[model samples]
Target: MDVVATAGHVDHGKSTLVRALTGMEPDRWAEERRRGLTIDLGFAWTTLDGGRTVAMVDVPGHERFVGNMLAGVGSVPAALVVVAADDGWSAQTAEHVAVLDALGVRHALLAVTKADVADPGPVLADAVARLAATSMGRVRGLPVAAPTGRGVPELAAALEELLAGLPAPDRSAPVRIWLDRAFTIRGAGTVVTGTLAAGSVAVGDRLVLGGREVTVRGMHALGEPVERAGATARVALALRGVAVEQVARGDALLTPGAFRATSELDVVLTSGDAGTLPAEPVLHVGSATVATRLRPLDAGAARLRLAAPLPLRVGDRVLLRDPGTRTVLGADVRDVDPPELRRRGSARLRGAELAGRAPGGAAAGAELARRRVVRAADFTAMGWPVPADATAVGPWLLAAGLVDELAARVPQVVTRYRQLRPLEPGPPAEVVRRALELPDVDLVPAVVRPPLALREGRVVAAEAALPPAVQRAVDGVRARLAEAPFAAPDANELAAAGLGPRELAAAVRDGQLLRIADGVHLAPGVEREARARLAALPQPFTLSQARQAWGTSRRVAVPLAEWLDARGVTERLPDTTRRLR
Candidate 1:
């Protein structure tokens, strides 16, 4: 299925041509039908030659409804541009043509309507020439009098040819349906209609809407119920778990986690002069219209700050229109997640940087180079193609040379950390991440070099020697414990020797001393000797018996027994008696 939108001035017979082609009434409101003006968007579908189904979105042509017109044509790839033969080239016609061109709509066919009232040749030639200068390039023009059925068949054939030339829609791409209508039905709950520009949606599929998940309860394509619908088809979805008032025309139904909502972006002006752009213009993309502040960075580059966030991606074409003058500037999104301009002349510098790169042609490598580190999921969600050379560190993608750069800094950071805290193991992974300004703590291991290693959860030097003063104090404690193996140093004695909690902890981490309890410290090998002595005791011996066997006091015996139990070397019975395992 293919979707095409009608573009031209009002009363130029856009809805009429669509009605003639599809044999369906496009105008839904009684006031519009009586006035013969399409105030809002109208929809109709027809089967062209070769049985290709085409959906037509009849957009209003009046300047008052230009927003409505932009919403209808924003996502459609093909267009049927209407021009009244008698009216010739009107102001609204030129505006619509400029819009189609700015949007990069290449598949188009001109239909000079009201041919029965005037000779169509002049207007057909004139409109075709106008379209030729735009992105539509050279389009085939046909004179169609819908009321008389003259040239209608030829126009349909031309439309079929135009639709055939369009690039095939990617059904596997992420689903992003910009809804044009949202209303409630008596039994259906909430129903929203939009063109499925890419990807596929099934009846049971779950889609993201305004940060929450909504179930596709039912769906219809071309006014008929369908279990599934693919790209380029006009689809109406009955959504579960949402109310009609919660949704609006600009809301998008998306494949969950497939898109990132951005409130700011960098863009390249594809049309219109950036120098003359208004400070605040209305940005139109898909069915969304947002108030934006445009900052011109260069002649062709600019930055936009949207009043609200939208699920935008790289390569999306957006239209910026001054609501007061209705002047539109076409912009191609270069970066959806752009860096902040903080320093003086940063905006111009950023523009200079962006000018060197092609808009929407940025590869993943370019994005990685710019960001240095990004989540793998965010990279995919932002519509960047994951490159083969991308350095994947867990869920993160690192830029080229980032790992080497971080690795080089790791030892320096560790040394500084050790100097700040003389009696501590190397910094934890979180500390390293914060010191390096890394995005994820998990990436710490990826940047750790040969001399540096992650032990347990902390980043440590491979041979982290204790400070000389703490080492000497630990050695004194070790020598004392060697003489009286079970007689661990008390806190007062360790403090007198300049061994505090931190020094003890450092000694334990270095494997030079063992910490039996909070303040109790012993030689590293003393626990093994104690365990052997306890094993020689009777089965299910009491704590007092174990203490007597190891020649240790009650303060050391209880914690030692608990530590042995924790290590699975011994079992403590319900009566508080212990046995060697």
Candidate 2:
């Protein structure tokens, strides 16, 4: 489905034309019916001659209701400009045209309405020339009259051609629905209606609204319930986990984390009705109306302080209007997340940097990573390529320079850590991650450059050796174990020889000692010697026989047999004896 909005001056026959074509009443309010004027947005739809369904959002044409009109057509990509032949051109018509030009809406059709009241040739020619001078250029127009249904079929054909040329919605992009209505149903908790500008939503998909997540209970597109709906379609979604009182017309339903909602933005301003924007203005973008303060930075650039945070992205075009001053400024969002200006002349430098970015206004790849470490999902949502030159740990993308710098400092960090905590094995992976200011431990191993290694999930210096005190303790343990390779020393004896539990743990971590049992340690190769002796004894042997063969006590023999059995070096029989495999 293609959705287009109706734009024109007051009393331009927009709704009347829609009623004649679709046979449905567009005006829902009794006051509007009584006044015979549109005061709010009205919706209607019709099937074109080519069988294409097009939804029409009929905006109010009165000057007093201009804000309502902007809310209705802010995100609608196409327009149908209605110019009543009897009224010719008017002030509201020019305002609508300026808005379309500011929004960069190029696809449109000019309908010279009320042909039954007067000849439409002069008005049609005048409207075409005026539109051609604006951003819409020359639009195709035809004479239309709702009273006698004159030229209604031709108008539908033109609309179909116009809609067919508009680009298809991006279903793969994140969903951002600018809600226009919210209401409560008897059984359904809350329901909101909006034109799905992009992406697709399904029955069970969760949407973010006002910092809270809501589930989609049901969906209706074109008055038919559906499991999922795509962009360019008007949809009403039944919601769960939210109340009607908590929702409003201008609130947005978005894919969580896909957009950065910030109250401050750095942008490049283009001249509109106002030569330079005032200090305060009314901002209209995607159905949102915000009061903002504009501070000029440099040539064609400024920073905006919005009254509230908006779900904005880089390269979004927004209109700044001051209803009090009657000024308008077209702004292109350059950065959604900008740093605070705390230093002298920082705003100027920031403006220069923003000006240096590409026309799309998004940050460069390296600059994006520098702002903060981003994941693959962030890259996809921002339409940035996953950088190939950077180090990727799991889903994160780290700056190559940052990774290299961290890698270069690992050896120093590990040495300092070991010196401070000599009793421990080494710094844990998390410690290394924090020392480098990384987001998580996933990137720690990747930061270990050549000549550096990670052992037991701890960063280790490749050529690391024990400190002097630990080295002396290890030497005492080695000498004692070598004299009696199988007769392990007791804990008290080892502690007396300068090898305590901490020292033993360090030796084991460094691969210099193998712990056979509690309070029992051996030289690294002593276990092999014991295993060889046990195998030489017999095919099946008792624990006592093994202790005699290895010349050790029950403490060492029991753990040795069990350790050997665990390594598949020997098997234990059902009768509680051991056998070589």
Candidate 3:
């Protein structure tokens, strides 16, 4: 994909490098140029040879805009990391690399600017070695000096070589563009722009931003209109229906079903300068930010429980920000297990799950690719970060992974629940998941139906349990039906037994006790037959006559007759009551 971001220390000529590379200046805001720093996000346009073009996001190197930096970096396939040759590497450089790791921006060109002044040897070696320790480790450095255009062509060639060596991004999937800027043009409606992560978008394409559906009336990439734009294209879309304020920087513009959101993701937290965070710390991942509780997966790693669903992915580089301390911690998002998980504390270890995995977060649950993956949407329903896709097999999702680890444990619990409540539907899905310590999504493949089907509101029981007294009352009612079917005990009479209101309610909820109406009880299946016979009668009949036809006494007949009259099933204007014609 054409998405790219710049990284390095503050005032390291990152903005200058972007302005020189794109021809269009990224630092349009006066505040930025005045401060001589990229206080906010800056955008520039560049055209690649063979008609391919790219949009550049020059992220702030200052520690203050770390959140803003995360918002702009992702949704791009490649990055242009700008480190000054003179300054070499600094704290912000490490922080920027950490943020890139958090975002999972892997493909890049390490642009060493200010080569005109500083000795290139030490700066080049240091930046490369430092980057090697983070997600941008393998990036090749290209020394350039804007004053004399030194090494410009070489840098471009190196960028080309890096892009060529990299495998083509998956553009045939759904479209997701995280907004870096959203505004209203005078003539056009509200327009939102960002790096297109995948798939294609065209004018009139229906899209969802932050879950609200909108129509795309216009589309532009590099300021030109085309039928469609795919992965790696920078795009601006004019939206219809949604208000400008409704969309924000952190919100994702996605094709429905492209990604699912969740609050819990299994992440491998790297050990570094950010130090150990409090159990609960604020987290900034991709364009989303929220408070999170971290559980140590192991040394150098941890699982994060966020306050809400964030649009993210496994193997996407992640930057953890501790606002209280004003330091940014770096890590690669090796895994994202959905519906959030209550992670048990321990050191995070590298294993087969993350083996051969990219060091960034791409949610891996993508539609077309089936790498270690899980259904992000299923995780979404479970209060987990929404992942882009769910096309991976059962083992890919954490729940699925746990299910494999705990193989027979799940089936065992399910079997016990079934045995205990043979007649009931089953226990709540959460209950089963909690009892077994398995990822909630893992249960999806093993179960016969969706979790929603099992969680139908009321307390579900496996066995239809009736107390002895309640059962006796039920039997008494059944016997009395033989004598006076119409006058069988109402719910109040049943309540006379030790069974309380709550017990009766539970029975009603379970569909065990069918209370037809007030002061009425017929033989099982008798009500329907009685209604059919009564409906067929040609005219109204007296209560005495009705009793003779149904074979019941006045004790049963009088109220039943009144019930029919009240229901308008039959009219009783005269001495005799009758079923309606």
Highest TM-score model number: 1
Who is ahead in TM-score, 2 or 3?
2
Best by lDDT: 1
Clashing pairs in 2: none
- By lDDT: ranked, best first: 1, 2, 3
lDDT by residue for model 2 over 1-581, one digit each (tens)?
89999999768988898898788888889998889899998998878889999888999999899888989988898999999999999989988888888888889999999899999999999999999987689899999988898999898888999989999889988899998889987887799999998999999999999899999999988778999999888999999989999998789999987877879888776554233567888888988899988877765778899999888877788998878754556778877667789999987887787767743313546455555567766654553445556666798877657777778888888878988987665799999989888878888887787566888898776755777877887887788778888878888888877887788888888888898778888888875787789868867889899889988898888888898888888899999988888
Poorest lDDT segment (10 consecutive residues) of candidate 1: 355-364
State the lDDT of candidate 3 residue by residue for 1-581, as single tens digits. 35567777785888877766667778768988888878788887776653445677888899888777777775556777778878878888877776666555567778889998897778888888877776666778888996677887687666656667666767676676777788998777799888776677888888888778899988888777766787777788899988888877777787765565657766555546224676777776556667888766544556777887776655555667677765566566655552333454213333324334443234333311332334445444222343433334443454324334444454566667757754444566666656755445445445423222444532233344555656666666667766755555555676675445555544455554544554455555555555775655556666676777777667666776676667666677655656563
Residue 198 in model 1: lDDT: 93
Candidate 3: where is the Cα deviation over 4 Å? Answer: 49-51, 102-104, 270-275, 297-303, 312-317, 325-327, 330-581
Q: Cα lDDT of model 3 overall?
A: 0.65
lDDT of 2: 0.83
Deviation from native of the Cα of residue 212 in model 2, angstroms: 3.8
Q: Model-by-model lDDT, in order?
A: 0.89, 0.83, 0.65
Q: Candidate 1, 179: how far from true, in Å? A: 1.8
Shift in Å, residue 353, candidate 1 = 2.4
How accurate locally is residue 476 in candidate 2, as Cα lDDT from 0 to 100? 78
For all predicted structures, in order, the TM-scores are: 0.91, 0.86, 0.60
lDDT of each residue in 1-581, candidate 1, tens digit only: 99999989887998888989999999889989999988999999988867989999999999989999999999999998999999999999999988998899888899999999999999989888888999999888999999999999998888888888899999999999999999988888999999999999999999999888999999999989999998979999999989999999999999999999999999988876787778998999999999999899975899999999999988899998888777887888888899888999998888877766763335567778888898889988887877667788788888888888889999988888889986777888999999999977888889998788999888887888998888888888778777889998777898999987777878899888888888778887776898889878889899899989988889998898899899988998999898887
